[model samples]
Target: MKKNNNKLLGVVATVVMAIVSLIALFPIISIVLSSFIPSGSLMRNGISFSFPWDELTLSNYTYIFTQSAEYWTWYGNSLWISALMIVLSLFFSSMVGYALAMYDFKGSNIFFVAVVFILMVPFEILMLPLFRLMMDMMLIDTYLGVILPGIVAPVAVFFFRQYALGLPKELMDAARIDGSTEYGIFFKIMLPLMGPSLAAMAILQGLGSWNNFLWPLLVLRSNDMFTLPLGLATLLTPYGNNYDVLIAGSVMTIIPIVILFIFFQRYFISGLTVGGVKG
Candidate 1:
């Protein structure tokens, strides 16, 4: 009787989860379907599960691909900025985190505490001071201005530090005894061990940088310099809304993030779970 009950419960749980997954995916499915819809229909109806199958057309995708010069430029800016941010952030943040976890140095605790504190503080509070600093340094309206402020993000540093704590310190000693330099040990020995953490952080950092809007909007003056989020917003005016291009472009924007996750998904779960275990 107990065995039969357990099996029944498992079946019920599976059905519940399947329904939940479908519910979560409804919006994504609606958007993809709506991309094939005509601009006039989209403006009139907004997005919905119901589609006029006969009216669905590929013109939206065509318009975005061929005529949207500004769209491509925004896409390119976001791509490079996101890519640079991921590489630079992982490089610097991991090192800082590793040092804090491995070495017993002066003021290390204070630094870690500061990182945690900063992580708790909202970005809005820091934006004013950061803006003033960027202006003084003449980095405003530049890629550097956007990328520099967040290159060593507090959350990344904290995550890496927590993950690094669980790494074996015996390897560091072994590398040092073998006459390896500090940089050599980190690059050759420690970094390889951090693959999962790196992959997880890459996905997270990429998503954050790609979707970022406010800071880019505040700094970037030129239409060409605008990122995808900023550029997409400009499509809506008091006179008109470019729903067709907007929906199609939004679909295209999901592609890179999807690809990033697909490639790293094998590590994503383990990385996030392991980092949290130590903290």
Candidate 2:
């Protein structure tokens, strides 16, 4: 009787989760379907299944490929900026996290506490000060301006620190006994074992940077330097709302993130699991 009840419970849970997943996916589906509707039709129908399918056209996509030079420019900018931000953030955040977890320094504990505290504070409060600093550094309207602030994310540090705590110290000791330098101990001995955490951070940070709007909006004055999110928002100018372009553009933008998740799907789960486990 217990076995049968357990099987029944499992089936009920699976069906419930499937329903939730469909609900979560409904927005993306709506956006995609809307992208096919003729320009101004979505504004009129407000996204109903009752709209005639035969009237849908591919001109939205056609505009993107052939007539959307600005969109492609924003796409390329996001690609490179996100790619660089991931590299720098992973390197610096992981390095700080590894040090905090492994080494006992005078201020190490204090530093970790500071990181936690900073993580608790919201970014909105820091924007003015950060912008002032950016001005002092003369980084405005540049890729560096968009990316510099995220290079050492506190959340990434905390995640890496927690994950690194779970690594075996014996490997570090063995590397040290082999006359390996500290850099060698970490790079050669530790980095390879950090596959899951690295993959998770890359995906999370890449998505955040890709979807980010406000900071990039503040920093990028030049249209050519604008990231995808900002560029998408630009479509809704006071002069006229470009809903047709926005919907189709948004549908296209999801492709890269989907590809990233597909490529790192295996590591992403394990990474989050391991990184969240206690010291």
Candidate 3:
């Protein structure tokens, strides 16, 4: 009886998970399928069960890569911005996390609380003010304008702090005993050991920077400086439609993030888990 019940439960769990997986995959499947459909067919018949899968074409992708110089330019811009954001966020967040984790000083609790407060504060609330500040500093329309703001996200600092908390204090103490300077210990010892956390932070920050649309849209007026998301938006004209190109652009935007996740999935999961556990 016990063995039969266990088998039944496993079957039920498998069915449930299978259903959930399909539910999660439905939208992605729909997008990829839609991207290959001819623009004329898509207009004649909206995405439906009867939509002809046999008449798939690769023109959307070809047009995006070859015909659209703007798409490639924007893709390059997004990559550079994301790279800069990841580097800066990792450095600043790790240093801040180390300080919060290792230092013992007055108002430490207050400082931690402030970091938490930043997590609670919505970006929408700061958007206008930050834009104004950027205008004053003449950062508007510059790559630095977009890249600088995301370099020290509260979430990044919070994740770093959580992972840092798990580090053994004896290592730092030993480094100090060896007469290693504080900077030396941080760069040489602490940073190396914090790879998992940093990798995790990099993925998060990179995704955020890459997908950042609103801020970049607000700050960047020049076509040359537009990121992937913003440039893709331009592919859709105000009065008319370009479904094929639009879908192609969307696919282009998703490819990098999907590749990043595939490569660093382990670190991403570990970092997220550690952050959740600590927080």
Candidate 4:
């Protein structure tokens, strides 16, 4: 009786999960199907439930890759910007987190409070002022202009500090007794243990930077400087149509992030779990 009940529960759980997965995947499946259909067919059918009766065409992809060098440039820019932001965020956030976790100093509570306070403030509110500051610095339409503001993210600091606080204090003291400098202890000892948090922070920062439309759109004037999201946005025709190409662009934009998440999914999951659990 007990064994039968357990088996029944497992079957029910599996069915429930499958349904949930289908619900989540429906939109992605629809987009991919839509991307394969001809532009004219898309206009005629208007996003059908049935699969494409027509053959899949590579034209959409080929058009972007070969015909439009601008698309590739935008893709490359998005990739590099996201990568750089992840690297810088890791370094700065780790240092800040470590200090907050390990150090006892003047106004430490006040500083931590301030960091948390900043996290509550939405980025949209600061855009105008931040843009003005970038203009004052003559950084508009520059890589440094877009990237510099990204480095000082408060959420990264918060995650790092929480993760670091959960680490053993004795490890730091042991390093100190071994004639290790503060920086040495942090770099060589603490950072290795911070892999999960860093991985989590990297994914978050990378995704945020990659998908950032508004900030890049505002700062980048020329079409040459546009990132993936910005470039994808430009695909919208003046008539508010071009579903096939738009879907193709969306797919192109999504592919890199999907590949990244798949490769680092284990690390990402572990990082998120640890950061949340420890905090």
Candidate 5:
């Protein structure tokens, strides 16, 4: 009787989870189906899951590929910025985090506290001063302007620092005894161990950089310099709304992030778990 009850509970739990999964996936499914229909139909209906299958068309994709030149440019700009942010942020933030975690330096605790304090402060509070600094440095309207401020993210630093604390220090001692330079010890012996943290941050920072609009809007002057999110916003104006390009382009924007998450998903969960546990 107990065995039968246990089996029944398991079946019920599976059914409940399946229903929850479908509920979560509803919005994504709706957007994908909406992308197939005409933009006019979409604008009129406001994204319906019950639309007739025959009403679907491929013209939205065709327009984005053929007619939308600016769309490609925006896509490229976003891709470049996101890639640079992930690489540079990981390289510098990891080094700082590892040093804070492993080495007993003067003001190390002070630096960590500062990082936590800065993390608590909102980005909006810093934007005005950062904007002025960018202007003073003559980096406005450039990719450097967009990428510089975010290169050493506080959250990434904190995450890395926390994760690095869990790394075995005996490896560092052994590497030192083997006559490895400090950089060699970190790059060769330590970095490989932080793979999960790196993958996790790459996905997170990539997503943030790709979707960022306000900062880019403040710094970038020319339409050519605009990132994907900024470019997509311009499609809706007082004169007209390019719902066709908007919806299609929006769907395309999800592709890179989805790919990033899929590739790094194995590490992402483990990274977050371990990183959080130490601190």
Candidate 6:
């Protein structure tokens, strides 16, 4: 009887998860289906999933491939910026987290409180000051202007600090006893243990950087410097819009983030669970 009940529960859980998965996938499936449809149909009836199988064509993708070199350039810029932001953010944020979690120094807690406070404040609030600072530094219209602000994100730091709290400090102490320097102990012992957190942050930050529109919009003045989202947005006008290119280009944008999630998915959940604060 117990075995039968357990089996029933397992089957029920599977069904529920299947339903959830389909619900999540519905939009993506819609986008892909719509990407193949003609732009005229889209303009007539904007963004619906009533699939017109007979009217579907590959011209959207073909245009992207054959006619849009600028689209590819925007894509490349987004890719590199996201990559650089993720790499720099992970390294610096983890280091900050480690210091906060493992070290004891005057004003450390105060500084952490400041970090949390900054995290609570919105980036929209910071944008004006940041933009002015960028101008002063002469980093405007440069990739450095875009990349510098995201490299040490407060949310990433907070996440790493919370995740680091769960790590065993004995390893650090032992490494220290064996003549490992502070840098060596962190790089060798703590970093590997924090793999899940790093992977999770990498996915989150990478996705954020890739999809970022507002900040990039503020910094980037030229069409040549546009990221994917900004570039895609430019397709619209008071006149007829480039629905085909927009749809196809938007579909292409999802590929990198999907790949990042696939690679780091194992660590994503565990890291989130560890990093969550309890009341």
RMSD of each predicted structure:
2.2, 2.6, 2.1, 2.5, 2.4, 3.1
Clashing pairs in 4: none
Count of clashing residue pairs in every prediction: 0, 0, 0, 0, 0, 0
Best by lDDT: 5
Ranking by TM-score: 1, 3, 5, 2, 4, 6
Q: Which ten residues in a row have the lowest lDDT in candidate 2?
A: 270-279
TM-score winner, 2 or 3: 3
lDDT of 2 by residue, 1-279 (tens): 999999999999999999999989888888888899776777777777576688779988888888889898999999889889999999998999899899999989888788778877888998999998999999999889889888878878888888899999999998888999999989988988987789888877877788889899888998888998999898876443577678899998997667766887876565445445554
Estimate, for each residue in 111-161, the C-alpha lDDT of model 6 and write its tens digit: 978876877788888999999999999999999999988887777787888
Quick one: ranking by lDDT, best first?
5, 6, 2, 1, 4, 3
Q: Candidate 5 deviates by what RMSD?
A: 2.4
TM, every model? 0.91, 0.89, 0.91, 0.88, 0.89, 0.86
- Which candidate, 5 or 6, would have the higher TM-score against the true structure? 5
Model 6 / residue 207 / CA error / Å: 0.9
Model 6's C-alpha root-mean-square deviation from the true structure amounts to 3.1
**Candidate 2 wrong stretches, greater than 4 Å:** 1-17, 237-241, 269-279
Considering lDDT, which of the candidate structures 4 and 6 is the better prediction for this target? Answer: 6
List clashing residue pairs in candidate 3: none
